[model samples]
Target: MAIGKLFIGRKVRELRLEHDATQSQFAERLGISLSYLNQIENNQRPVSAAVLLALADKYGLDIAELSTGETDRLMSALTEALGDPLFESYSPTLQELKLIAQNAPGFARALVSCHQAYRRNSEQLASLDDRLGRAAALEATPYDEVRDFFHYVDNYVQELDTTAEALALKLGLQGGDGQPILTDYLDSQFSVRVVHGPSAMNAVRRYDPAGRVLTLNPYAPAETRTFQMAVQVAQLYASEAVENIVRQAGFRSEEAGEVCRIGLHNYFAGALLMPYQGFLKTARDLRHDIELLAARFGTSLEQVCHRLSTLQRPGMKGIPIFFARIDRAGNITKRHSATKLQFARFGAACPLWNAHQAFETPGRFIRQLAETPDGARYLCLATHVSKGVGGFRTQRSSHALALGCEISYASAFVYADDLNVTDKSAFEPIGISCRICERSNCASRAVPPLRRSISVDHNVRETTPYQLS
Candidate 1:
């Protein structure tokens, strides 16, 4: 028997085929000789960093996938599958397994898929346990802590939107790129200039009454501009009003109150740019085309998702979408959702979701159907967006945002209409539950969840310890 090579020739070849480009065309586009490109594709030559970057920039391959393969993604699935404390002893080996991913790419991918199956089973078991006292314990985790925080903050978003819209209306700043003009309005009306400086440089978009000119960093997004404007409005125009709201929240500390105050100010700013009624109308009209909505409202992709999550106004609520921002390593940094979908408290998400795939085709929209252990399915859509904290000359990183909902709500999204949804079986089944699945037949399980009991039948051996009938 021959040992298989670790080279990624097939994937490279597949990329070219997927884009419908000939070898010569790909070689020319990559600025490499046809023979050399052929050699690289054949695994005769390894791809260099320059070539890898070119491929990523040209073909839009996810940098993480191009570099780490699926090791990180697999690690996430494995971590979730090992929800049981019994696997704690194998943690070091798991770390080593990740390093091995660089050398054994095929094995890494296989582990990811296998781990996904294990997670599904664990989640199933967890669902059964949800009826017990476990529900309270589950609700008290760090994950729910943040989620409840966001839920409370969402109400603040609604109030701020209403107030900010009224303010924007009064100022007669309804359309066009309003940042500069809004800055000017603040300088003229409030006797303060907005100045931008490094976090260490004293102020981040600060108002300087002495300078008399609002100096904004070019790195700020349109939404940031609006946010800054709203902060200024709260400080100057609605200081008493903002204070009043904070007072009602009954925070134990001044710091918490201040944090909530600043957050509310930001909510107000988003509303100024995208007033609730108008933004929701456009979102519905465009069928939730994020790019179109971003352009029409002069906001960022994140801002659009954030706004979408807030369309939960009783009978007029839009199809609830959960928003999560994750890096290439599958680490979710920020999350907001109107739907019941709960993000992983700690560890990586399912590799099958569109969010994970967004890293592959940077700018394009990808959609998929995801299933939880409870047999709940959702339609997910994800895309990548980039932002900078400095000018064009400064370094910037790209981030991905994934938004999705239950499959029943698919008819409300334009992205769902464009997907191949006729074959329900073909749609990948995924889960948000990390510890309750009972598909004990999976080999990729890192650890059995704490709730499952292992049954031993020496004469009748099973693939996994736990059995669900």
Candidate 2:
């Protein structure tokens, strides 16, 4: 019979240090030789079953739990990092990665983090060039700066989240819909009367601080009204927290700060309307049916999607999902991800993406299984949302929203129920955007990839004008 080494040397050493015990003292206590104890602590020898029991008896330690699938997770992350084209020429073997994961987990984690940061910066650079047509990001606009801020943060603002969660509890959002509770809160707290009617200047929400009147657009749906009321509450009550965040952000322009402040207010509103813990529980319970979630929380589909993306609390994380809204023109207006999939920052999204197709089939969900150029597969869901002025004269505001996650998480979503997720051929090939897309034969590519050599044979007709080399 053979017992494998735990590879939890650092953990054992840490526990010993916590108890202020030397190797000899720990060895004496565990009834093992000092050299054996040293070998175990250095991951050079197996931690015997007897020694494990002794450590538990002596130190109240769960040493076996220390190595519970950590090495596997680390290896998986390392493998994905190596799968990047940047490491293609010099990627270490899988055995080396596994050894690093087992013996030097901390170093392995640090390497993964560094690679992520490097990749993020590179994407930002490419995005800056795409959006602003400039080399330096200093020239970026307020919207650009704010979008990047949220993108880097994984779209979760913790302080604001806590504040909103507390507010949701105080307002009793979990037990009921957001409308009545939020309206009563505004009335009692600020002496503000919530009047639903056509607001001045066709605004969705207008708060007159002096008059203490909150007017909402009558044409807007009940969900919109409730959400705007929450936003007003945030503006009224969560002003300090919002300002603190804006100040700490150190945005280059006051305009960016203002934009960020409004964005925070909206974020607080979403969190308040659908409090994190409650929303997460319900989402999981309902298997993340967007319509069901929307009905439960009294929020719009887009709101639910956006809130789901922010369910990234430290210990109680929801599915890591990417959410975005795109206009008919193919512009990604709002984008955030708690997953590996990021939206194209510079231009319109890929033409073949489900979000674009959403505009064609309004009021119905469009599900897609797609693979990016980086070999990442996702289960994408898209639908269009329309906000009409209740008449034909005024234009109707509509946009397509998309929610997605990697194929590994597809089973958890109701939208993926009928998808041929296991079949590679069923997944359509897609990209972030054509300019940065490395796919050589994308039929929908509008522009050539950046920093890549391409061949243009005018005589030979291909899917794209330029062939990626």
Candidate 3:
């Protein structure tokens, strides 16, 4: 293999560039010389265990992600992108391009960035064109805005979680067995009637303050119910507190602030459902099994997953886990985590995870072992969840979520012990890193890593180039 075509090296160079570090500056940080760094990027040197460890500890990059070059993800993205009609002219030459991706790292990055810029610009242009005024029409409903806000925060806010916890304790609503579902608690304790009915409109959840009642469909999944309760709780108890946080955060727009307020409400509802200690105990006893937890609490898998992520209480923390729900089309609809996974800031996720695969095996829980660029491995459990539309359309849809943690903690839980296969090696290893993975060797990757170069030369296209940056 030609030198300067290494994924790890390319990543090192990108990070060095991002920090604006001269080779010497980066070398100093790694406690290595410029020559050693050069050797690593050039594929002349293998990444050392010491340096890998340092990257994890010092830079906060997951060690497993760094080492394994989760190529499945990269190739998947590229394949999807290449499938577009815009790329049809070059479709016949994809094999050549893939080879370039493996052999010439610089060109691979340039292409990825170029494609990203193109997509962004196209979206902006499409928005501006606004043929049917769809943007404005959707804006009339707060749905898109709220979704965007929650999506922006990845559905978990540490500050809000803390506030909810304090409030739950102060209100004597923090017990495990005693805690009731939000609607039930409201109706039984506060004389509020909680029921399920068709929304007069498309309102996901609504509270009738005048009627002193709350209504959500029995068909609603655990997540929907939890959200409803949160909305109701926010309307009833923490509206003022939510406003305070919004103001403190300096959100100038009233719309944005209101969205935060609603989110805070849901956060409280989740806390109420899963009181820190009570829920944590059950979760541990249950070995953090999601389906069992959902059944026990009358919540959905997503709700259980969300609660699991929030077990980040200072003294009583569960294993750090990442939760993501994606539709069949690969759009990540909801995501939250306290783990080391880095979601791509602006693009789709890797396609190989069970999150997407769950579509094929609906109602079945699938397990996968995923590695990040820094060589961190996690055992993931994924399942599909659905919701119903009550009225005329009577439409139904479903999505999938993957719940995972580092493999070291797998044996500690029942979910880990039941992967359908006893041998860990029998399970396949997958990855999620999009930018810096150097596994030119993988066939399942959607797109090659941005760190690899392209090879236009004849007879010697190295598998996705990891050029010495």
TM-score to true structure, per model: 0.62, 0.70, 0.60
Report the alpha-carbon TM-score of model 3 versus the true structure: 0.60
lDDT of 1 by residue, 4-35 (tens): 23345556788999999999999999898999
- Taking every candidate in turn, the Cα RMSD to the unseen true structure, in Å, is 16.7, 23.8, 20.8
The lDDT, on a scale of 0 to 1, for candidate 3 is: 0.64
> Could you give candidate 3's per-residue lDDT for residues 1-469 as a string of tens digits?
1232224766666667877878887788888778998877654567777787676676665654543344434555566666654575766365554445544546666666677767655544433433222322223224345544554454556666766666566556543333254555577666788666765235556667788867666555545665676557656766666767667754535776676676667677787656677678888888887778877765667778878876776676877887877877777766655666644433466766667878888888888866655667788888887767465586777888888887777875686675544454655556553444455565556565654554455555554332223
lDDT at position 256, candidate 1: 62
Off by over 4 Å in 1: 1-147, 152-156, 173-175, 194-204, 209-213, 221-223, 252-254, 391-398, 436-446, 454-469
| 1 against 2, candidate with superior lDDT | 2
In model 1, state the lDDT of residue 405: 83
In model 3, what lDDT does residue 191 have? 77
lDDT of 1: 0.66
For model 3, the superposed segments whose C-alpha errors exceed 4 Å read 1-115, 118-204, 218-227, 418-429, 457-469
Q: Encode model 2's per-residue lDDT on 215-248: one tens digit a residue.
A: 8888777888888898998998999989999998
Q: Candidate 3, after superposition: displacement of residue 437 in Å?
A: 3.0
